[model samples]
Target: MKTYTCQCGTPLFFGNRQCVECGLDAGWCDVCSETAAVSPEGTCVSCGTSVVPCANRTTYDVCNCFVDASLAEPGTLCRSCGMTTMVPDTSLPANVRRWALLEAAKRRLLYDFRTVGYPDDQLTALPPLAFRFLSDTPDKHVVTGHANGVITINTSEADPVHRESTRQQFGEPHRTLIGHMRHETGHFFWMREIEGRRDAEATRLFGDADANPYAETMKQYYEQGPPEDWNEQFISTYAASHPWEDFAETYAFYLDMRAVLDTLRWNAPEQVQDLGDDLPSMLATYCSAGIVLNEINRTMGLTDLVPEVVPPAVVSKLQFVHDVFESLRTGVVSQS
Candidate 1:
């Protein structure tokens, strides 16, 4: 993710709602990928559009996106909120905050996608990436995953304590609402962009996409953990469970790497320079950044932010993912 700055020159974050330096309201300009100060009248100077806070923001305080009111009908949502197929019961105060956390993460994910040229409008038009923020009840346990372009996230994951406990239970060093979104959205993209057309290449890199006995596969995975040599090939133990998961995990890592590198470049352009084209060069830059970042985290008494070491095998898979994303961006691969 690139670092954004307010019109007042204060550095802004992806989720920033106000500029600390100037005390002005901030709204994301999708066209320019920057957080610009909104006029008191809620107009976007960059695009000259009459804008308003996204409905999700006004009603639930869950979003920071601004919609172009002239282009959209009355009560229309912004690009990110428009993609939500479901939201938790906001009548409950806890659910309201949980949904807000989920929406914040979702908006960041959408921003990253847009930065890579996969704008929400284009993505929604083709295969339609959507979301469902659900809460588990006595009768229904919400499992987080992607199916048919819809990514479902259990609202419980929004609670840091519960999320940490679940992460520990799964033996995962890194797991967050955004991480889940990135991983599941990886599955959605694979289905939309690569599944049938690039199955041969995907199978060669990950595994057979067609051999999907999902329930039995997952059952076996939980019954007996990943293979002893799993670390040599897969990004994580969960990734080793299935070919599809392997792809998604690797895809998520690719996004993570891209985000870290982009931030590093944005903060220190002269020192970081360009991340090279090849996988090895990119990994080298990422590892260096990870080392510095982990040390900073340690100072704060937090765990290593980017914990997993990328093996050669995983690097190969990342290369494939990067290529696929490039294909998607450039229309090198036919959507049909």
Candidate 2:
């Protein structure tokens, strides 16, 4: 989550479509790894790759990513949108906006993945990653989860009113489109990168993913709730529902903390440090910054921006996640 700037020096963000200072069209340059100005024809200035704005952007204003025309098939989607296997029926008026929100979150997740060296090609091959944004209809109930590398999300979660009500019903303290994308993609990556690797050690930390019947475990979890002492070891109550979920929830928090820390390092370098080797120090920096952010939200009559406390046990889980990410990134083991 590095801060980007317009060629003219105006600070930009990952999702910016236009530079406010230069009034030039802006987009993410996959080659340059930053938001840069796009020519009227949508070419990447640095790479000289002939690009086109994603189809979803042109048709539905849901994406800002550019597809490399030379690499993609004619009339095909950009890297992010191409991963979508299904979308809600566009004939329904509300579905368009909901799908847009979902796409925005997906693109953010993809951007973070790429920043961390998980390229789209590597992820979408073999046990490929894909998405289905579906709406619950009279005839079908859309459940959100990942299976066989495909992630499905219910579009109803995009509507704030509906989302808030459901969050309250489930007694969840925090819920967002981005959170759901990060959490579910965790499942896909776990299956793809760690599931059967002879040397992978996630099973030792999170418990065997295949040790129990997932459906029955979750059914009982929903009916009886997580163990009363769940907070002692799990990041969230839902995470205690099953081993796979424990991994996903911890993985999602790792992404969350890393993104926030990156932003802090960019904007407040004096207060943060480049202590990448010290996980405990990084978490302390995040918590210190989060307290200030929570105060700002309080002043605005809003909820805390980051509410969860990272207990010692949860920090150990996050450290394991970091080790796995490092192994995946560098193709070397971080620890025995």
TM-scores of all models?
0.93, 0.92
Give candidates' CA RMSD values in order: 2.4, 2.2
- Residue 165, candidate 1: C-alpha displacement in angstroms: 0.3
CA shift of 100, model 2, Å? 1.1
Q: Considering every candidate listed, which one attains the maximal TM-score?
A: 1
Worst 10 residues of 2 by lDDT: 197-206
Q: Tens digit of lDDT per residue, candidate 2, span 1-336?
A: 777766688887878878898787777765555667776776776467777667777788777777676776656677678789999999887999999899889878876785465645668687688999999999999999999989999999999999999989988877899999999988887777677862246766777767768989999999999999988889899899998899899888878877777777778887686545457877888788889989999999988877878888888878877767767777887763
Q: List, residue by residue over 1-336, the lDDT tens digit for candidate 1.
A: 666766677877778788788877776765445667676787665566667777777777787877766666666687778888898887899999999899888888876786566644557676688899999988999998898888999999999999999999999988798899889988997888778878887889898756868788889999999999999999989999889899989988888877777777777776467678556777888888889889999999999988988888998888888777777678786332
Every candidate's lDDT: 0.81, 0.80
Question: Which consecutive 10 residues in model 1 have the weakest lDDT in total?
Answer: 114-123
Q: Give the residue spans of candidate 2 off by over 4 A.
A: 45-49, 69-74, 119-121, 198-200
lDDT of 2 at 4: 79
